[model samples]
Target chain A: MEDKVKIIEIKKSVFAANEKTADDLREELKQKGVFLLNVMSSPGSGKTTTLVELINALKDKIKIAVMEADIDSDVDALTVAKKTGVQSIQLHTGGMCHLDAEMTSQGLNGLSNLDDLDLVILENVGNLVCPAEFDTGAVTSLTILSVPEGDDKPLKYPLMYQVCSLVVINKIDVLPYFTFDVAKCKENIKMRNPNAEVIEISALKKEGIDKLADWVLKQVKNWKENK
Target chain B: MHELGIVFHIIKQVEEVANKNSVKEVTKVVLEIGEVSGVVPKYLHDCWKWAVENRSEHMKNCALEVISLKATSYCKDCERMYDTVKSGRICPYCQSKNTYLVTGNEVSIKHIEVKDEN
Candidate 1:
């Protein structure tokens, strides 16, 4: 007697399919004249504080809104809204560690009034691994690394460095207190992703905020001009 | 991050395939998970076990099989391949930093087994 079990050959990639959804979402965002930025970092990396500064810096030049995502909290969103006085929405991942393209789209739908917004920033759940794995349909993905996170973060979390378009080293004001090697950090990031842009900033003391603001404005202008 | 969500996506894909083939029951699902794909096989298995029981009646007892692929990196300077986990981006042989990942970064379904009534 021969084995009767039938094996169906299906060499399909599930992540690739999810990427298709992300691409579609990107197209939708482009059509809506919105530049979606997915910002990711580890917890306590000052992602909210950076966003608050970003809102203040870019809000005067462009229409900005933010979506804060966490496992279970509205505190960051509340802080962003209170500090920046901008349109802010909180998204709970319901135990999920990362946001996929579809989830980002759902959040955008819930955001309402996207018609008037030039940029929509999604503050992804604080984690180095999973957030880098999923494509959140953002025009650009930004990763924040604070002085306290150490310089070896890129070596440990290469995926985060590889996926991000820009890496912002926050808390530069406190760099003198920590042994964080900025040159070594940039080298590690470049080793992982040669094309990625690295910018150092102190979100608290407003150091290097002007350069970041200029880069954001340039990206937005390029998106509009190209569209 | 969320292996459960990934499991859900996998289940949806399997259900679609099963529906197309008119499968009465899905006996097993074989997934080819890359070592560097960031998906934990144990968590995926746990999620699959729970999801099949609650969601798919035909796949209530479906077994999940994961084939973890080894991560390998190719050294541009040495023209050699090495274990990515052990050697990392640096080539162990030539001590060169010019290296790139060749494989072990994929999450895909290899095949599936369906119950036969013949």
Candidate 2:
């Protein structure tokens, strides 16, 4: 007796399903008049600090919520809730490195007043490599690079820079101690993605926080009116 | 690790395909992985072996076949192509950094083989 085997052709990208889910999630958010922002950065890059500053600045003007994603612990969510006094939830990736579209939708479900919120900020896992690969159905993606992380990060991690529309250079106050060249960093970023907007800020000292706040408000307005 | 996540995604997709076709058991899956897609084949295989048995319903003990594609970058200045693995973003031929990836960085499912009762 001969063995019978059947072959089926299914030529699709591994990210195809996630992409479709992300697109559908985006549509749902747009209909609800909610703007989702995904923030990606390396660990200890002041992502929480920047978020606290930005949220404090915008909390009065609009209804906002924060989703803090990490492998373990709920420290970030606690910090944001304490500082900003807004709705915050923690999402555990169950040892996974990044959050995909499905996980993001689950996180959104955890929010109590998602429909009334004008903006939902997702502080993605602290890794720059993995988070950039998966889209979390965000209206805009921002990557934060600190001055101490060196200016050549864009050259090393091209995909992260290419996917993010805005690049925030945090810890600019410590620039004198570090040898990070802002001009060279901008040039390197332009080499990878010509249209990426860059902003410099010191989240701890509250320098340039107003500009960042303005940028966020503009994004929310544009997302609501244009799209 | 991301490899584990990727394995889960693959299992989910294959399970959907299996149910759509009313497949009882899936024996093999073939994937096309690029040389510089950032996915390590060893890790992927290890994850696949563990996930198929634990996470998947119909793809238990499924064999994974990986085909690697060479990475190449096209130089806009010199109008020539170079091996991406050897010469990263900078083109080795013209020493110009105005180059983009032509191929590679792909992770796709090509086909699957299953058992037939007939």
Q: Name the candidate that leads on lDDT.
A: 2
In candidate 2, stretches whose alpha carbon ends up further than 4 angstroms from where it belongs are B71-102
Q: What DockQ does each candidate score versus the true complex, computed on alpha carbons?
A: 0.56, 0.58
Model 2 per-residue lDDT at A160: 87
lDDT of 2 by residue, B1-118 (tens): 7788888888888899999999988999999998877777889997788899889999996899999989999999999999988877778988787888888888889998988867
lDDT by residue (tens digit), candidate 1, A1-227: 65377888889997776799999999998998999989999999999998898889888888999999998979998999999988999998888888888888899998768988999999999999888888988998889999999999998888899898899999999988999999999988887777789889999898888888888888889998999
The true-versus-predicted C-alpha distance at residue A186 of model 2, in Å, is 2.3
lDDT (Cα, tens digit) per residue for candidate 2, span A1-227? 87688998999888899999999999999999999999999999999999999999999999999999999999999999999999999999989899999999999999999999999999999987889888889988999999999999998887789899899999999999999999999988887676789999999999999999999999999878897
| Candidate 1: segments with Cα more than 4 A from true spot | A1-3, B55-57, B73-83, B86-100
Question: lDDT of all the models against the reference?
Answer: 0.88, 0.92
- Tell me the deviation in Å of residue B107 in model 2: 1.4
